[model samples]
Target: MSRRKKRRKQEEEHMDESWLVPYADILTLLLALFIVLFAASSIDAQKFQQIASSFNNVLDGGSSIMEYQAPKQPELESLPIVEEEKKPLEEKSDKQKDKEELEELQRKINKYIKQNKLDDALQTKLTEEGLLVTLQDGALFDSASAKVRAEDAELAREISELLVLNPPRKIIISGHTDNVPINNHEFESNWHLSVMRSVNFMKILLENEKLNPSYFSARGLGEYEPIATNETVEGRAKNRRVEILILPHADLQP
Candidate 1:
């Protein structure tokens, strides 16, 4: 064989083997990736985290010798706190205001009663119905007659004036009689006498210009509602009376 032929034969026999090193390295990396994936599936959370962190460190930077600072995030102000709006307090009702005014009037009436010293004849009481101003039969009228006495007229006038209110209230003048049978000229029975007495008393009250006549009323309960027993003289006298009821509620007219 010639020398050139021998050289060509030797080159062909010893083909290029440098690619096997890189191929072997690629196979090793693939095997390592498969092993890591299998391990991740089976390993606990903590162990997996640790392994992942170690792998990242090895892949990114093998050593912690160099110090690097992350970009400082812009300083953020705390979110503004928003508060709720508060509501105003509630005002009093019309009924409540009326009640207060009525109470004040009662005090004034009580003071007048105390100063005048008419405890026996004129009596005042506060009740659920209204303020009741009770007058004895003798104080208001003479026996068997519905007319008020001349001397006591001044007292009746004063009471009528006192009844005059800014916002007028319902005024009911009621007359009552004892359990006595009567058949006379002026009065047919006790019922007639009581009715006339209430009407006469209301007429005197209506004389006050300041008071509203529409609010005034007159009624007679002849021997029906008696506070005391009518068997004795004193009890019968007590039973005969007149009541001036001042109602504060506008809804209750009578």
Candidate 2:
């Protein structure tokens, strides 16, 4: 009978928590009611954050996160610049126009040379340096004379007129000579002959009022600079010639 009573007491002590379960359910209901009330209050997140930032700024005496700031720009050195490449097409067009003008001038001179049947004595070439007009010595001079022939002076004038640009260009009239040294016709050496020949030819060219004398320069290359071999007759003849070179770029239009 005592064992039965002890067992009953133990079972009552370990009863399946029915009263505690109702208490737990009441606590949970209170929690849910508090959550519903809090949710109905409707707090604005952005305003709350801004107010928090303001309080932080006041407390710490630092800049506020809510303050306006201009966006940052890239550094000047980091930028990809093209100051030189601006107007690239314009620069190329200017150079091309200058080349075309030179070609046109060469064509005119070549036409003149062909019409006058002076092909053997005169030739025109347009090089990178500019327009080059080469004239044989025999076409403008006698055996040992430096003076240009009277008949050829007209030709020189015609060429001088053709050479006139809108704005004049620098023209170098260079005289070349064969290896044979001269001591006749008032020329003491090949140097004197070459110099005088270039000077006389340039003087005739400058007689045209359209041509500028200051733009013309006379140079003498006395057997020192030869285009052909000095050992052969044909080579010597080829070496004895005059050259007129119109220099580049000084008269370009902007």
Candidate 3:
């Protein structure tokens, strides 16, 4: 009877030791699961991907529940740019051609005056007002006379021919006289003399059918618009004159 009781106590001790092996195994599995959850929460995208790959390789034979995907970026819309166009080259070329033509006309008039030995009685200048042709009063009229000389009528005809060479532009004929007072049967004052002189000269220029009648006009400034002093005879002679102004086409007054 004593041997049987000792045998039963040894069997109970062996049963208690057998239960300890299964409990150790359950604790080890729970610890591994908690460590995996903690790493997934704190790790960056790259490290998480590496850990997922390691877990797959070690535990599930390369298959995994966790997946690593990169975030997508947003796209932007494009817009078109606009620019202004410049002036045409042909317009600039046309302006240059007009300037050259005006310069050539000036040269031709100067050459003609030089050849005829008319430099003393006639003067020419190219200015902002266009070509200016100045003729002394003595060359076209006698003392205190508004009548043009017979020989000087030829000068007016020649000038008209030259004007026909250019395009139609404003032609202004203005007459001026010295400050000396004058009262005669034919004229009352210097103003009357100046007006008659300018009108007569313009009439001769109009005899050419090629010249435009509408483009021509006349003015008489009298003694108030003298170019020189009335204190001397030479100065007074210079002040008494007729001026022909050829204005640019763009500068014509309405």
> What lDDT does the true structure give each of the candidates?
0.78, 0.79, 0.79
Q: For model 3, how does the per-residue alpha-carbon lDDT over 1-254 read when each residue is reduced to its tens digit?
A: 69889999999999989767555445545544655677665567866666556555535434332333322333566754333223345545665666566678878888989999899988888777778889999989988888889999999899888888556878899999998888999989999999999999999999999998899999888998887889999999999999998876672322
Poorest 10 consecutive residues by lDDT, candidate 1 = 83-92
Winner of 1 and 2 under lDDT: 2
Best candidate, TM-score-wise? 2
Question: How well is each residue in 1-254 modelled by candidate 2, as lDDT tens digits?
Answer: 69999999888877855446455445544544454345345535654454455445534646533352322333567757676776677677877887898898889988898898989999988887888899999898987788888987888888888888986788999998998978874988998889989999999988888887888899898899998999999999989999999876774534
TM-score of each: 0.62, 0.65, 0.62
Q: Candidate 1 — number of clashing residue pairs?
A: 0
Q: Which residue ranges in model 1 land beyond 4 Å of their true spot?
A: 1-93, 252-254
Residue 58 of model 3 has an lDDT of 39
Instruction: Write the residue-wise lDDT of candidate 1 on 32-98 in tens digits.
Output: 4554576754566765665555545545645321122222334789976443322111123555666
